[model samples]
Target: MDCDSKTFTYIWEVNLDEFDRVSNLYSPPFSSWNGSVEEPWQLQFYPHGKMSIASSCLALFIVHRKLHHVEMDYTLMLINQKDENETLSVDKHSTFENSEDGFGPGPCIDDDRLDSPPSEGIYDPDRGFLVDGKIKIGVRIPTDPIPIKRKVDNMVSFTWDLSLDRYKAVPNEEDLLSPKFQTINNGEKNTWQIQVYPNGVVPELEGFLSLFLVHRGKDAITTQFEISLVNQDPTKSYRYTMEDTFSHDLNGWGEREVIGRRYLTNNTGFVFGDNVRFEVRIPLDDVSINKLEKEQAIVPFVWEVPLADMTSPTGEYLLSPKFMTWNSDESDTWQIQLFPNGIKSEKKQFVAAYLVHRGVKKVDTSFSLFISNQNEENTETVTMENVKFKYDLHGWGANAMVKRSDLEDPEKGFLFDGKKIKIGVQLATDHIPLKKTDSVMVPYTWEVKVEDLKLGTGKYLLSPNITTWNGQNKETWQVQLYPNGLSTEDNKQVSLFIAHRGDNEVTSRWSVSVVNKDPKKTESRTGTNLFGYDLQGWGSRTFIQGSKLRDESEGFIFDGKVKIGVELPSDNITLSIDNECPVIKEAPACEKCPAVVDSPVTKATPAGNPYDSPRPSPAGNPYGSPRPSPAPINASLHNLYRELKLKTPDGSEFSINHIMSFESIEKLISNLMRLSGSSSNYQPSISSYKHID
Candidate 1:
């Protein structure tokens, strides 16, 4: 349920004014104390709407103030603080690349080219949707790197029903200067005015009409809004719009270039029935109050350690020595290690790990181990977050730390490509008090991701090669399974084997399993034993008895393929994550850094066979080195072969010292019984295709 511990939260609050007429606006970047989208982040509000449906609903957006790239997982909300139930939100995972200036998700505006202005939302001011005359929007980011399709969004009270013709410019110069036709526009926090000079106030264009927008707010403050003018007659109802930002030396924006005397005097709707109308929109992107952000300055303390594949191999299944980190405080050290196989003593049958404290002195802290898989498709990507590895004597870990099953699953990135991998450690001290404002939680989180190289799964024709242990990739073997009985039904017997296909003797602690397909019948068998590669091929003839296999009631047969699985014991490790671990800076200081002889990448053997390696073959293993193929082996086969008592005639002939294999003895007895006309061992023959079952 919860995403791994590598997660944090960020909250953004936006307050908008003149919510009805304002098309949209963006707030100043939120300072660090509040929250940051990795950097300064601003909120964009659309009183009218956003995106495709701007005509129907109001919307909010996020904008990055800097021209850098970022990926974020966000949850945005439009909350009616007065009425908690009237909250709206959108969740999205967005990535923003560097823009010439700022990269922002717009309010229906094309950043590259403007084909049109922002579309308007259904705003009706008379319905009273504002809470204390302001709209508040909130955004929360959960995943750090991380949508509303709802019918209930049709609720009313957020728009304006008031007509645009309520206010107008007078017909004459004398009246235009009158107090009745001219007034100030009131905003939630500041005030501004529009002055119409029938007689140009500036001498340059005396005969032309002049319009000026003025901001009477504070000197250092800035305000952005939209203004429009309309000729009310049905024949001339189109309105020309202008978006404006006013502050400091720039008090307003407008000019006489807006119209010609002929266009205005034409009975010609300009003075249609003697009235001029206009609309002003000032969206509230943030609260009206000006804010002063305090300074934030503190570099986090971070440490890095490379997990080299030394001193341990995948085949070594018992616990190994712990890897130590240099102590940051010189008080206590942290220890860590991996168990390629599962830790059997604890019944933990998966890759296990731990974080332990080694020094006598302890400290208080927490850490997150990032076993990162750079491969996007890898499921083994790990972020073990917020581990409180105590400064106490012992440590915390197990094979279950990174579930063994997940490691073995190809899709799970854990070690699907067993290679040289990097394990990251992030440390964070307890809450540290600040000199000025509140305390800060300083964490040493790494910017780099988890990355690893892989050892190959060898190539083979008749057998499939698999690598069980990932460390140094030494313990690799081969295996192939026969779903149905290997031979025809008449003498059908499920077979499993360990082939001697490589150069050296392959030693394995293995398991063979056969599951009954029918849940109701529920019959199965699991056998485990130690195996050593000797002859050409070794293992069992009866991994599952043919008689018990075809029993319709309790047979092991499932679909067309009989399920046979093979597993072997891996290795173990004992380590811990100490809150006070020192950073491993040099290889010489840490004695555990093994002297490694890197193995050359083994190329797929030229088509022939792995057993055809150029190396000389050892005695009985006529093949090169005695390498074993990976297949389930029946333990009883080895024990049965040990009781051999062969009879060789005293002649100059070949060696005949061997025990009767169950299959051979059964065939001989079956023939004798058939000659006697007995029905005990009779069986119907099967097709080759069916034999593959």
Candidate 2:
């Protein structure tokens, strides 16, 4: 049977009575060919089961009768003679060397199940596998050569003896190499040799023996072999087995510490007559020199597009000519996508660029994109390391490469001849694993100048968002300045905070500083906290007093501008998702600048002393009209309050008698009305309070 060309099946029927009479039986030999080699095979059976499974189960095996090596995938089945559909089967892929008679699933079927009733098992006298006193067995096998690029090689062993006395005289720097030997694999000739280092090549193993298998061929090869130090009693030999790839850059792979030099020299079994015999064996048919080689060469691709072509009104993007990372066309193809105007929400703000894979194969690559500037040193470049490009995610890039404005700015010199832009991509053709390091403390600083700081509206002044990196993760952060303080501060102080605007929560140690003319006076506040969507901003609400900050002598204000600096130590920062973040209210908008507002009386007055009357502001009040003083406290209720302090719902406190603002008096009256209803003894008429217009 030329089974290598197609699927082959054979059926053998045996009489159970005869099978039981003979302890062991073999079917007639059948001829099968794999490639050009002819192999004779037979089916072996043990009716009462094999040695270990005797009388408990049946044993079946496919036996090879010739001394040939072949790898095959086969299926063995015990047919239910009564139903056919109810069969017991086992499938396996195995390598067979005629040195061993055969391979099989020992104790193929349980005797109890094989002889059970038809309803409960596969065998029964009238309606199961044992019908008519016979059982049918079948085998299906594909005799084709193993599906590999290279032909399988038979087990081959080579032995070489090293003279320990001679090696002891050799210098540690020298290697003892066995004579080169040739082998043929898949019709290709190759050379290989063994190298033994008396003193290990690496420092850690200097006192040990090092053994390696080196491929002398210029091409790459993958091999599976065993290296053993032959002992006087062969069974006691010390052996090491491994599979590895050998290439031009790495032509050998083995253990640097095979055995301690002293131990090997003292063992009589290993060192016989001052010589140690080392044997190298390719132990399986699949061990061969694979011919397919990996291409590590990198190729550069450049594309120049006219600025007008990218900015044209017709299309959102333009694709560059396709190119590959290798010289051959079979290599993965890629193209550069130039979004003259960016993508999605980033349109018109940034000049986006991406590397698009044009091939079906997934590629692991390290690629860099470059945007050329007139000054070669100032060219903008972005690199993505250890990235993968596949069907699901075929492209990746920065939406904000160089800002569109910056690219078009004549002074920036990004445009060549005021008409074209040059973009280049360098791709690595092969993948190399990257080594990881421990967390490192990286520091970053950002500073911005606020012009007309007091004139800015909204709840706070926001600095431009800056992007920062911690390892492979990136985040956007912005500095927020509340010149008038938060609501709780009551416009008496300036507040400074940093907000994380990224989707992920991060923990970082950060500091915000208000620059002063005198270095010694620079006011800075530091804190470590986890910032996220729920608690977006963190800092001091009383960063600096409004009076001191605005005082000309304090030097906090320079040229009507304030310089704010923020520093972040990213050593401990890590990103994570908070699936259950709570909703937090945003800060209220600033009604007016706190610097111009009159600071409300926050201190308590001496007992029995009259409160200070209101004074008009020279600059005029921004909050409607000036406020009148409050009425005297009711005489009947005077004993109930000595140093009266009224608290608001938001937790701000004020002295009732000294309250000058219209807003504060209204809150006091409201509290009084609510208190009067709750307690009869504290009742006070509305006439006791005065409101200012």
Candidate 3:
């Protein structure tokens, strides 16, 4: 094979701002095979410089990604950003076979300097090093030029039916409920009940269906469950999940507008044989920790300066890298370019610098840029905060950062032995956007069903036998039912709630309902209500709070059992199919015969709407106010996160779900995509990324 045609290479930048934040900091290891939390090939810098048994110089090590003990060639470059075309660079290339013995350029070229003095030219500015107190570092990795055949992911689905006529029959009444509740139990011996209101009881939520999960067990067991309102027609299903720790004080969780009522009652889509199928699933496992806590942490981004790059040999004016550090927010990248050989005043002996936005749109932010001398004897520190920053493809800040007379003094420590310097940045916000560079939202059908639900007259709390996946289609959700009347201040009313497991922010729209066992009547189930607009994680509003539900005249309960359901009407997955990778994979169900599940739903509520109020308190659950329901999800790759669970080149299993940020998402994907051979039960749904506590 031709060497150039078979080898693939990728380039990235590494910032060394955290060089001095150490009581005991050293270089991190990297690998070409196994990847680490940092990157495939990692870089570490020592401010005081480093010396091997044979060489002496400022040390920057290239460690193999930890655990990745593979033989490979590596290189590190010192680039001058001043000139886009003709700047020179200092590069180091070598090969290593073990992680325990990580390698970088080191000082192999200056091995004779083992006995040199502190004033040596190896890391000194007089030798074309450290461009304006900063350096640009980059790396290249190889990949297989050939592609693999595409394959399809395993497809799983469920179906059930719901008959709505068994409940109350009141057209003009404010609220309606089942004359009796449906009781169910789980494998753990916990009991629960399901309640539904055809017409909402809340003043503003009057037109929607209101569903609830009611806990009636003796123990404080946490439950997980899934419920879906399957459409009878060939449309998508609406789904809802709950992963929760429901105790006596905090027992229930729910949502409104799981789906619209027109589809179920009038045969718009959900009605089939005058009956709509509803499903319930309680799987027997817990979602992974990465899935449970989908939100990752961001921080103070920092970069370092190598005196060798202080003067742009090409007279251009910068020495900053291209990548942002630990950036997860969809926010744009703000950069700092240092100009040692002053921009406008080359004759005035001044150091110039500018800040620019690498992103496309206009951005407003405040940052703190710290420039301090490495020498403790010199108290010279340059600090700027709350500095107004607004920039586009152009730039801002001074053309000359400081007068040459100020940073070059021998005793200043800004230059240790007149060789190196230090600098870093800290920004102030976390706002991720909806669209991304890579990843597309594909469609699929994720469904499950539960049957033989015998809601005898007595009090009962039915829960799924095992935990279920809430949003990801894994086992992360549950349902609670109250067959007997639930306790309230004045009257007896059946109650219910939909529960999900994790505590991450969830943007969802699903349907829940009471299926009328009788198919003769036309108007049967409750109308779908919307959730996540105001009350984030979990959603609930009283469908029948007052004494009106007890009326024997309304024909509330016609029987002892009513099937319930939930589904996702429009769910799009964010996936990146090269469209060129020859690997053969399973065709997405959304194509010719897609399973109708979730869809991107948008419904905003006014201040006076039931959607605006806190979930009403249950007579049994002592927690007076409503609390949020957590859903377990992979935080990174907002789309198709589960696909990242694969062993890295470092021989260790890695999961990107917890590290979903701009840096990791872009840098890790290439390696991760190559490492993964397993597929995921990926369900797609658009989220607002809001935290509804």
Candidate 4:
């Protein structure tokens, strides 16, 4: 194929200040040609670098947005604004299939080089790539498209014969292993084997024959192949065809019941002189092995709270600084709330910790929390997998993170230098969704016209409901206008409120205006609030003076008609989670524990809202107080027990004498299994057994 030798250049003027503020910046789409076809392409620039290179270098990628596949040679350059001859550049060749596939010229420049002074580097305020708070980036791409590389198929086949009498002589529950064989797939040599069970391995399929093809390669492989039980007559063979990927965790795939043993033994045509043949055919063209890709591991966020902070005479809970799950704009922010003296029933006996969502939208996440130890190997951890956090259900936690007595024990190492405690949380980064780059704000305005204003009967007038989109959710809102001030306002001023008609919580910036004959004289009150079930609406009680609004000379009641307008930023408004009341409940006491008093321990209450007030005695349950509900299962203990099952080979049950960590349980089980001479594959079908007094 002839290459299109023409070269095209594209220039992007980047503002350093804006680049520093955003994680990624994109250039306008440009056109490129693959052979005779033209396709659209764009550039993606990462300010703090991408993935593992973050904060260390600047990265750039060529993105192809069209379906056309293209291969081209390109050069990325960072122009030195002061001296054009000193530009830094790198050349690369890549193949892009679609928008999801992109290639970069590695790290275009080091961060230090871009931030140093002119004497040390080229990126200085007076003389380098970044001059006047801006830099120039350019890319040159050759229109010539490289020919696609083709791979040849290495088709290979293997056949083996088994003695039917020998298979029948073996135990029905035992698997007969075949000798290892070798084959070539896509230019790579691989080993394989076959396993046959005359009678099914599982108890559920006792009279059936099972067959499996196992790959013995060191790496995971994907292949398309066919396996067959050759019959006396060629066309009558039983064939199984499939395409699958096999990894170390699951190295084999086949049918549990390939054929009924009774049928096979009874049929004369199936076996030749007490021998059966099995054949495997694989076309290597479609076979491929998994290749390792560059990835950034999720680093856990750690917070250290002073021991004094938790045990202060003033009972104030500790709140961690807000943090993002990932180093990207789309990442959600989260916070940790720690109650030194646990709330409700566990109060004074345990330490409680909760994970709070501080983001604008809902997110599905799996996360783990850990309490650090002086020796890292002894740290304690609890995990919550596949949980959703939204506006209403914004926080989740364990009421009994650790017993107060155990935490205060000096030898536990939970308290560092007996001064502070370290806590860490790691979020499953893959589960977080990428937020949209462009956020558009839509405005909702409602105008209520009142004729014969003074003749209005009710204390407040309601406007028709308007439906609009708030971020990704739809919400309905209405305007409440009081012609005469609320009774609490002594009827001296008019009142206006923006009521959320929907059931869900919504955050918005709103304004209520009393329209006048002239726009300049319009009187308006503006405020921002999170409207939800706890607080349905928010507004100003003293919106406007009643006399001024009623006077014709004031131009407020023009032509005997009053106009009231309510404006709400409909879209792009952040939906904040409400933290008015703690969303935790008292847990039931363990039946074996001794009875404890329900009266709260006396402590200095921080002078704040009623929500933070000390818990009252059980006998004095006041009205409007948070109701007592069942608390969540102890995550740390549940996680440890869930992975263990203790049952002997003879079906006898066993139980641990005391509570232990998952590692301890695993080690004990391993030793037990070893001493019992049990098969590694033996999985006991019994509940997690524990004996705690």
Query: Candidates 1 and 2: which is better by TM-score?
Result: 2
- TM-score of structure candidate 4: 0.24
Residue by residue across 18-81, what tens digits does model 2's lDDT show? 5555767777656454542334567887665565544434477887653334678887778776
Q: Stretches of candidate 3 above 4 Å error?
A: 1-301, 313-315, 322-332, 345-348, 375-394, 405-409, 429-693
| Model 2 lDDT at residue 356 | 81
TM-score of 1: 0.17
Q: What TM-score fits each model? A: 0.17, 0.27, 0.22, 0.24
Per-residue C-alpha lDDT of model 3 across residues 1-693, encoded as one tens digit per residue = 122332323222323344433322332332222211112345555445455434454355565422212444444444445554533333455554432354554433544342232334333434443444444444444433322122213212223333343222212123321121222234343434444444543545544555545455546765455455554422234445555666773255454534334334553455554344555444332321111012323344444577777767424666454323222212344556676767754444767555555422234444545456665444333444444443233455555455666677656556655666665455443333212211111212112222222233223333332222334543233333433223322133333444433334344323233332232211111112223321123333232322332333343333432344333222233322222211111232213121111111222111111211123213222222233322111122144331245443335554443324344444554544455642333221223112121
In candidate 2, what residue range of length 10 has the lowest lDDT sum? 604-613
Q: Which candidate is the best by TM-score?
A: 2
State the lDDT of candidate 4 residue by residue for 191-240, as single tens digits. 67666776776868776777777888668887766666666645335555
lDDT of 1 at 134: 52
Q: What is the C-alpha lDDT of each candidate?
A: 0.36, 0.56, 0.37, 0.56
Lowest lDDT block of 10, candidate 4: 610-619
Cα lDDT of model 1 overall? 0.36
Model 1 misplacement above 4 A: 1-22, 31-38, 50-53, 99-129, 143-693
Error of 1 at 125 (Å): 8.4
